[model samples]
Target: MIWIAIRMLTGDRQKYYGLIFGIAFSTLLITQQLTIFVNLVERGASGTYNVPNADVWVMDGVSRTTDVNYPMPSTALDRVRSVPGVEWAVPHLRASASVRSGDGDLEGVSIIGVDDATLIGLPRNMVEGSADVLSQPDSVIIDDVGVTRLFEDGRSPIGERLELNDQRAVIRGIADAVPGFTSQVTLYTKYSQALRYVPGTRNRLSFVLVGAADNVSADELARRIHEQTGLRARTRDQFARDGIEFIVRNTGIPLNFGITVGLGFIVGVAIVGLTFSLFIRDNIKQFGALKAIGVTNAKIRAMVSAQAGLVGFTGYGLGVIGTMLFIWGFSANPFFKGFYIPWQIPLVSLAAVMLILALTGWLALRNVLKTEPASVFR
Candidate 1:
């Protein structure tokens, strides 16, 4: 009996193909859009996450996100380090400055100053030279993304020189750091080097990246720092969340992507509902004939379920595959760098496909069940 239903469902190549296309297109739309949305918003936190050694970040009370932070007094670092349960603390500086490229082009760049002694806040991975190269006189490390932007002609930036804040800086290394929201050129230099590269300010310390002592939780350490120093302290995860929330609250990205996803759901329902209904209605006589034989309504329902299952599986599989291919193809592009399809998104899309099939299948089955066995004679 199940075999007969499978044959019937597949026999109508037109409706079968239509149903698959509907599900596939909807899944592709929802999955791909959501993936891009998530990666894009998360870019705001890339700076925080790139430094994996820091367990806590202490900044000015008014500082919200990494990019929008206000520099704290240099004493703030000492205060944070003095707190109990604080293992170690280092001063971090993030400031923007205009740089004169080798070709005399003026470009805005972000200057990140890591600890001069420990180099604690530098990115863990290096694409070119070792992190130690920062010790070279007037040396700075450019992020991989910045390399492409600063030297668009595919020239090696290792020995390139740039004038920053009227100070000459030589690129000595390439750090494999994630690009921030603005995709600005990022130059990593020692705390002392950054001081010269950026215009002098009374308070040049943007943040104090801290590591919690053994047996000390990051949350607890942050709380202690906040209470003792009267500074805003956030755990690494908490700060990352703040970055994402900042983007969500300030931008229309969430609303825009949400609309696209919602439209995908609606399109799935409309197309699958209409096609499934028509397919069932056209096969009503066949269903009536089976009922005339010894097949009960329960058996008929199972048959319809099998048909929906096949369509759902095939369509969902194809849709997910398509989405994977899209992401993989663009992986080399700077815009899509680090873009990945989270496991949960596919499951979410699967649930949506099932819901679409269930609703449409239920509506289509009602007519078949009510038809009399003699209706086949008409």
Candidate 2:
């Protein structure tokens, strides 16, 4: 009986191909849009996540995110270090500055200053040079993405001189850092070097990154710091969430992506419902003939289910393959770098496909079930 149903579905190449394309296209749309959305919002937390050694981040009470922060007094670092649970606290500076490339092109760039002695905030990996290169006089490390933007000729950015805040910044190395949401060029330097690169104000410290002592929980240390210092304190995960929330509250990305995903759902339902209904209606005579031969409705249902299952699996597999190819192809492009399809997204898409098939299949089956066995003669 199942073989007969499979034959019936495959016999109509036009409708079968149409159904597969519809489901595949819909799945592609939903999965692709969601992937891009997730990666874009996550860029907000890239700064926090890049510094793997810091268990807690101390900032001004009003600071909302890593980029949108208020510079605290320099003494703020000392206050944080005074906390008992803090094993060590280092000052971190993040500020924006304009840079002049070799061709006199002006670009806005982010300046990140890590701990001088330990280089605690530097990225774990280096693309071209060692992290110790920042220790050189007037030295800085440009992010790999920034190297592409600043030096487009594929020449080595090493030893290239950039003008920042009327100071000479020599790119001594290339750091493999994640690009921020705006894709701004980022430069990493020692704390003192960054102060020189960025036009300084009285308060130079933007944040204090802390390491918790042995046996001390990050959450507990953060709590104690907040209580004693009267400054905002957040565990690493909490601060990352703050960054994401900042983007969500300020941007329209979520709404736009939500609409795109909803449209994918609608398209899938419309195409699948129409094609499935027509296919079932055209086979109504066949269904009646089987009923007349003593085949039960339960058997008929199993037949329809088998047909739906075949179409669903085939379409879903093609869609996922398409998505993987899309991500892999664009991985080299800076904007799409580090973008990945989260496992949960595929599961969600699968549930959507199942719901679409079940609803359309049930509606199409109603007409076949109501037809009397005598209808085979009509």
Candidate 3:
């Protein structure tokens, strides 16, 4: 019976192909937009992820995210270090500054100050030069993304000099760091050097990166620090989630991507509904003949389900493949770096495809079910 239903569906080349195209387009649209949306929002947490060594991040009470933090007093570092569960604490500074490139082009950049002695806050990966280069006079490491922005002419930024806050700065290394939500250029220097590059304020310590003692968990250590110092302390994972939530709350990105995904489902319904209705109308006589031969309406329902299943499966596979190819082709672009399709995204798309098929199939089946056994003779 299922084989017969499959044959009936594929027998009509035009409508059959139309149904597949509808499902594939919907799946592709939803999956691709969702993949891009997820990646963009996850960029908010890139700052925390870049500094992998930090088990806990201690900051001012009102500071919500890494990018939106208020500077804390330098004494906050010592206070956090005093916490029982803290193994070590390092002063971390993040501030915005304007830089004059070698070509005299002025660009706004984020200045990150890693610990001078241990260099604990710098990104672990270096693209071009070693992290040891920061030991040189006035040397700073540019992030990989910043290299593309600051040196757009394909020139090497390795020896490029910049004037940051009227202070001479040299780029000696390229750090393989994730670009922030704003995709701003980032330069990493020693904490002391960064103090000179960025305009000074009464409180210049943006955060304290803390390593938890082996005997304590990060969450426990964070709790102890917060209780002891009256400061906001978040475990690494918690802080990362905070950054992601901040973007969702502040930006219209969620609504925008959500609307696109909704439209894809609607489009799938429209296209598949029209095509499936036409298919059932043309096959009404066949359905009536089957009914006349003692084939029940229950059997007819199963047939229709089988047909929808085939279309949904084939279309869903094609859509996923198309999305994969799209991501692969653009992987080399700096903007799409580290973009990945989450596993859950494909399953979400598959459920959408099934819902589209089920809804359209049910509507299209109504006419077939109502067909009288005598109608075949008419």
- Each model's C-alpha lDDT? 0.93, 0.93, 0.94
For candidate 2, lDDT tens digit of each residue in 317-337? 888889999999999999997
lDDT tens digits by residue: candidate 1, 289-346: 9998979999999999999999999999999999999999999887788999999999
Lowest summed lDDT across 10 adjacent residues in model 2 is found at 192-201
Q: How far is candidate 3 from the true structure (C-alpha RMSD, Å)?
A: 0.9
C-alpha-based local distance difference test score of model 3: 0.94
Identify the runs in model 1 with alpha carbons over 4 angstroms from their true place. Answer: none
Model 3 TM-score, all chains together:
0.98
Clashes of 2: 0
- For every model shown, the clashing-pair count is 0, 0, 0
Better of 1 and 3 by lDDT: 3
Order by lDDT, highest first: 3, 1, 2
For all predicted structures, in order, the TM-scores are 0.97, 0.98, 0.98
User: Clashing pairs in model 2?
Assistant: none
Candidate 3 local Cα displacement, residue 191, angstroms: 0.5
Specify the poorest-scoring 10-residue window by lDDT in model 3: 73-82
Q: Which structure is stronger by lDDT: 2 or 3?
A: 3
Which lDDT tens digits does candidate 3 get at residues 1-378? 999999999999999999999999999999999999999999999999999999999999999998999998888888888889789999999999999997899999999999999999999999999999999999999999988888899888998899998899999999999889988999999999999988777999999999998999999999999889999999999999999999999999999999999999999999999999999999998999999999999999999999999999999999999999999999877888899999999999999999999999999999999999997887
